[model samples]
Target: MLATYPIAATEQNWISATLLGALRISLETLQEGNAPPEFDEALSEEYREDFLRGPKFKKAYDLFIAKCRPLTVDQRAQVLTALNEQNNFPGVFTSTTPCCSIKDAFPDVHSAANELFKHAFEKLSEWKTPGCEQTIRAKYHQLVDAHLSHGSCPFCGYEPLEAADPDLVDPDLDHYLAVSIYPFAGVNLRNLTVMGDKCNRSYKGAQDILLDEHSARVDCFDPYGAEQVKLSLEGTRILSGPGEGPAWVIHFDPDIKSRNWRRVFKLETRLRANVLERHYKKWIEHFVSYAQRHGFDITSTDGAIDAVARFKETCEFDSYPAIGRLKTCFFELVEAALNDPMTVDRMRNFLVESA
Candidate 1:
């Protein structure tokens, strides 16, 4: 969930044009639905002839326009807060709060506003629509570019792309602000995210993965912003007796923010695979090679663990195989053992014996 580059000029222009077209369509749509009592009293004969002629719908419609206006920045913090407060939109599209639903959130919603949201939500998904996919939704190559750019699944850095072909499109454009929950923002360029095929379909299927901050996860790092953290080993590790396999325990520091981000994509368990383990193992291989050339045992307990930890601080912080994410678990495992010289000696000797 890395931060994304800004929308290209052509893309922004297309989106603005499409939204303007949507506004025109929204006016016509409001003509279909009958005026609710909330604004009926304010309208006279000619004005009453249409749905948006009254203030109820017009107010909401105008607000919708303001929101859809080209969002120059990605965060939309102030705008979204205003939306939840002034617009009465609580982002309840997926509210687990019993009996709450999209329809319920906007019961007295005006037709113009409804149509505006409806148009963007419905049209954005339709490739042939004017501002959706510049060329064709099926052929929109950005999804492909996004997949290749990340080198791995954007959602889970461990999953690498094997090939790219028209018939075999594997990556998916995930709606970071889920379409079901926040329909109004469905087509917003900022809301769309490039994701791994499995992360989009199987692992994160129909579930909300957004934290207070999107693109906040490291593997899953925000490509748009910068961050810093000193990672630590934070879970129980079991020392093995002879013949037992090494135990891997990885849990990031306790923070609601990290948990929410991990929960959204199931990073904890899903990331526990050989793909990431291989990366962790490579670090040792690298140090061994470095030791051989330098005529020193980088793996020796004398200063090995601390040296690795220091190196990790310099190289692994906020990178991938990204740290404080899925791949660093093994390093933590090693760090745990290094804390006990007996365990370190046992493991180091064991590695030599096994080799």
Candidate 2:
């Protein structure tokens, strides 16, 4: 991921309090062998009437009752304990050394719990703030605008992130730890983030980040607090094999976190198709144009090398057009290649021919 955005404290607090309050009340009522209350009285006194009367709330309550009521007394106690632990979501999330697995956390809990949590997320729009009158979803985007003003998807750093407005389309809210497989984290603000459509639906759909296909535990970047991951093309080389174009032999770091991130998002394939292959020629052309505009003698080898180095220095990782890191690395590779007189002559010839 390219960046991290702040969670809206007001929205997070309101939704979590209301939902957790309702769930606790319903579970406690069921523990006493009674059917949970309908709507107004289901949640705590502080949050009952304002946010829990809607159809979405009713549906979520119904799902919980159907799933949890049938559990044995001991089972209900275990689930309640899990929910209590989940209340400390921030600690559980940040202290996760490698990653958290739902199976390990709730080993003996009923699988139906997953469905209940899923239902709550699906109806997230129903839980409105008390006086603000905006759904949690709507308020989240307003927070996004404030924090993530870069206007690019943090996941891929290539696509434009749409502004969330009532009149405009909202960006896709991705559950970083996918809600379907991970229970009790579906509604946590720390677990949710706005991702590009391609990264969310196309590449990372339902894929478990905690465990690989072989079920081995792996570390992944925390979407909320991860450092900006760097990409480098220093050791990458062009292959001499026959194909549509020069086949890139890209080498990535062997660290577990980097490997897991690359595998989960298919980053190599995407970086090649979306950034390297699609933009290399244009980048070179732009370099030549920049050199000409800056009064560089591109026909000379030393001047061409200087132009490449200066252009590379201008690339910023979080710049407007996106893919700045990759562009910088690509130019570094170009600058290195310029050390070869043959490559320099090719660049000079291309500059003249294109002119």
Candidate 3:
């Protein structure tokens, strides 16, 4: 669990402005007229500057921090109270009606509001010391394993009925942006979360749900006008900008399954071999062949072998993109085992080994 820092002076204003801007846009889109093109451009610029943490935003943040620190105790207390009030301001997409999931209720939004908050928060992760990574990851894992191993989704207070049985699932490094997209959030380490593979796979994706003109909707819950959280599972199965009702399992790929290798490889031995083999076979086959032709050990010393593995770890905040191409391969293997029915043994192997 990443410790959440309360929003300070500038961040509080940024979050409030971002949320208000998104609300304004969503309402404008719902009016009986065409949406202004400038709406998206303006929103994008705000997102780029505030949510993306660009240079201008950095300078502004420094000024805000400097001003906030010298506040008297009463002043600081007032800021803290305002931040807590913001929390109860009716979180966007809180509806749980059967015909309407949160996404279904909010249509016409460009992105998920919560995701914006998460991205903003993720910027803070860069300042954390080394122990923060392990601390957060371990806490996330503990919450997930408790539920998966015991038949629940602990973080959100959800549980799988025995009849549902989950067929297959694992603790996934989930961007809460996709699962429970909240506005004013920036998808930071604090907002990063864990969830069952089923929830991430079954419910979320890149589009807003269908909105009927007949049904009365709230501005905060509107998806089309809201800052949308684009869901990308398996690099496909995407819905965008007021399309589908919810995600349907439309595609599955075996090659991306890491647990497949687990069936044939132990944690230390076969896992590396299989990931390396997949990396060579899928991505760098041509380059590797050419390199071998020239007598260069590019596959070995070049770090291509562990590229995908490294990525898998870093996707959980372990490392950087410059290290290699490890994450893609590792993702594939994990996805493979997760989606494949026949790969139960492989999945089990992973659960035990990882545990």
Candidate 4:
């Protein structure tokens, strides 16, 4: 299984901000133009009322979707031209359009369109699914046995398969969520990730150790709410929160941490020495070599990126040095792309600098 990265909120920071501003401005403009100041009323009733489903509203929404949805690439260009002329969405035939103007023509279609846009935005917001330990364990072994007949870890980069087919992979245990959880506007494809046995089995039978709404009051770091997620060179420790302000610390797995530490440094000590020292060394060399390509001076970054990569390789959760920042960055960049699509280049540049 080949892993695809998440569409992060960090990627969309600027674009979301801009769209929010534009949305407010548009609403304000509409209100100012109203003879009796209907902006507040409209805003208040937007959720409760199905204005777009009204006869006139539905007509406009239907017209808009029919013209815009079935439009060929060339037709889409023309729709854009007309929308640009009115400073509103393309093909909004109604004068008092709700939320998105495109929905003003076909009110019934409005809800579906709104749902589509909402799902797309939420997907880009760094949403994650709970990792399943049992599923991961079974799948991890199957994947390893299939690709590594010699019972060796593929961390050495000499494995037969570099990726996996998501369709065949079992979701209950071996399935990853990010790459397929959200759908893009154009096509639908799922990215299943192939990981080593040790990494996938880090948590083993304890996969539900993450913070949730019920656990939020007791746990300081919320994986979703925090601004930063700090992980160690090994997959054992995690510091979560914003900036340098970490609020909580937790031990994911001491055994995994010890194994990962030894694996990372290729230490001569006795951690897994008899079981797979040679294999471990090969994997270590592969990653150490990979890190050098990114200008992440292994000696200078204080093994920062090394730690991050190792965490990713080991435990799927509580692994990732400065994970919160990376997640924030990724989410923001993705969000910006969804909102504007024009800022993708700038967001990419930002990622290069931040990394």
Candidate 5:
């Protein structure tokens, strides 16, 4: 990931709190050998009547209880414990260290628990508070606005993330722990974050953040509290083989978190297709025009080098920098190209032509 977003101050509202409370009560009641009907009665006695009236909540609760009925007493206890731990968003997400896998966490009942939570998450849209006006979905948008107000998508630092507006569509609320696997954290605010469509759907769709395909633990950045990871293109070079003009190597910090982030988002491949290949020539053209307008003589290699350095400085220090890391690295690449005597004339020619 290119940047980290600020953790939202908003706490889970009555909807989430009530659902979690009900789930816990249901799990505890089942572990004690209580039947499904008794679990229903228990929820009715605890939560408000209006909140429990919805068919959505009823269906979710009924399905969850039915799924739990097949589990052994030991399995039930394990599921309950996993749910509680996963719900503690702070404990689960405060660091880059990998947590236990769902299979290990819940042992024999992970599949059943995953389905139950998936159904429950789907039903969250229909669960409502008696006196509260905003739905949980609306609160999700508010969280998006809170974090996105700082800048672009925190995952890639490439696309812009817009706040929720009536006239505009809201960004995707990506489940950091994908619901298909870690459904225990489906509705946890810390697990949900706004991501660009490409990053969420195209790249990281349902990929597990905590474990690799072989189910090994992998270090992952905490979207809310992680420090920004840096990228360096100094080692990147234009390819020499056939079909290689836009093809070049991409480099990121050689840290486990960075490697995990790259693998999860396919960052290097994306950077090549989306940024370097697509924008390199356009950026160079724009730079030449910018230099000409600023009275730089692009005809001279020294002048081109100076302009490239100045552009890199501007990008490095700009407020609300767009693709700041990639831009800085790109300018450095241009500067290096300018310094190469073999490439300098070609670079100068392109700059003069672009001007």
Candidate 6:
């Protein structure tokens, strides 16, 4: 619980990588590494007869299968080990056009990959089916196991979030790079993470988390990295961005670099929910009451910031009000507001101060 917490990613992070590779092998076998639904039969009659129906497509597909197939246990380990590596797939597609190859009539990689996963996901529906079921079931069972063991959603650590692959068994794996924008990563293993429904569906639906120069390794919120997100508060609202903000009302950020993350995930709205607002207000109230009880002047901004800093120092990010990192950042707000007498009085008034 205390050592390496859910900063970078969960313990089951490797499950997606392995499954993705396994699925790709099976998926390609099903598709011949060609188009997903129906191959471009219209490309040419030669393609239609030979590649589509004749031995030509079968020949190419079989070659790819042989190339990727593992014969021995060591070969299997080597294949999986290679697959586990992050492709940085988005970066790999440096071409201006959307397609992987220009020769094909409809050479677009995005739609290709997207449809590939769409079919692959269906294949995952049951164990009886070859490609999809085994991997999807494994993902589901992992989530069920994690939830049962941890009690709290390991990803966000806030709500007693449920984990089930709703699309198959649950919708827990959020493509770190939303598959809609960067569909090339549709099957990329490291790109997917085990997330709660609230974090994945309710908040981050097609929003791109990888915009700007924000590297997923360094910036994105997963179970890896100790300091991926830095939270701060302006008044009662919590934010994560470039610097101490002039502040957004909840749906936005003043800084552009930080804005994409907040925008995609709707972090501002989630962080400033009424429940969290109450907790933030209560913290300010605690500080104010403590000052008043000792006849300490909060007008002394340094002292007030120091007090909040002390509280923040001992507080862990995963604890309640669930937005603890941002709550702790409210210490900065305390200091800023204390400098203005009106803001100070308003804060004091905001306090209920125990009967």
The Cα local distance difference test for each model comes to: 0.45, 0.68, 0.34, 0.30, 0.67, 0.44
The predictions' CA RMSDs to the true structure, in order, are 10.7, 4.1, 20.5, 22.0, 4.1, 11.6
Q: Per-residue lDDT tens digits of candidate 6, residues 1-355?
A: 1011232223223323333444355444444434322233222332133224344333433433444343344543333333232244434323231222111222243344345444333433332212334454455445444534444443444545444435444546566766665443454444555556887778767765644335332233333333234444444433223333234343222254445556665555666663355465566666666666756554555555555555556444435334555555666565555556756654333332321
TM-score of each: 0.54, 0.80, 0.25, 0.18, 0.80, 0.47
Residue range 1-355, candidate 4, lDDT tens digits: 0111222312322212322233344333333442222222322242213233234433432333443454444544433332232222211212233212233343433354344333323332232223423232233434444543333222221223333344443222211212122111101111122334443444222221122224221111111121222322222111222343112222222333223322332322211242223232343344345555655554433343343344334322211222322333323323333234464444333323344
Better of 4 and 6 by TM-score: 6
Instruction: Tell me, by lDDT, which candidate is best.
Output: 2
lDDT of 2: 0.68
Cα lDDT tens digits for candidate 1, 1-355: 4223333412432332344344434333333343222233333433233434345445655665444343322323333332332222122222232211243333322233445555544333343433344433343444445534545654555565434455655357666645554444445554555566777777666564432335332232332233322234355343445555435554554344356656766766665554444454555565455445555554577556655465455444434443334435555566567667668876565434432
Candidate 5 Cα errors over 4 Å, as ranges: 33-47, 88-133, 238-247, 316-322, 337-350
Ten-residue stretch with the least lDDT total in model 1: 92-101
lDDT of 2 by residue, 268-338 (tens): 88878888898877777788788999988877778878887888888764354346777787777667667
Clashing pairs in 5: none
- List, residue by residue over 273-315, the lDDT tens digit for candidate 3: 4333333233334333433455543223233323323334434
Give the Å error, residue 30, model 4.
1.7
lDDT of 5 by residue, 220-327 (tens): 677777566767776665433444563466666656667767778877777778777777777777687779788888799889888888777877643333355677
Q: Is candidate 1 or candidate 3 better by lDDT?
A: 1
Better of 3 and 5 by lDDT: 5
Clashing pairs in 2: none
Give the CA lDDT, 0 to 100, for residue 277 in model 3.
35
Off by over 4 Å in 2: 9-11, 25-42, 81-119, 122-127, 238-254, 317-322, 339-355
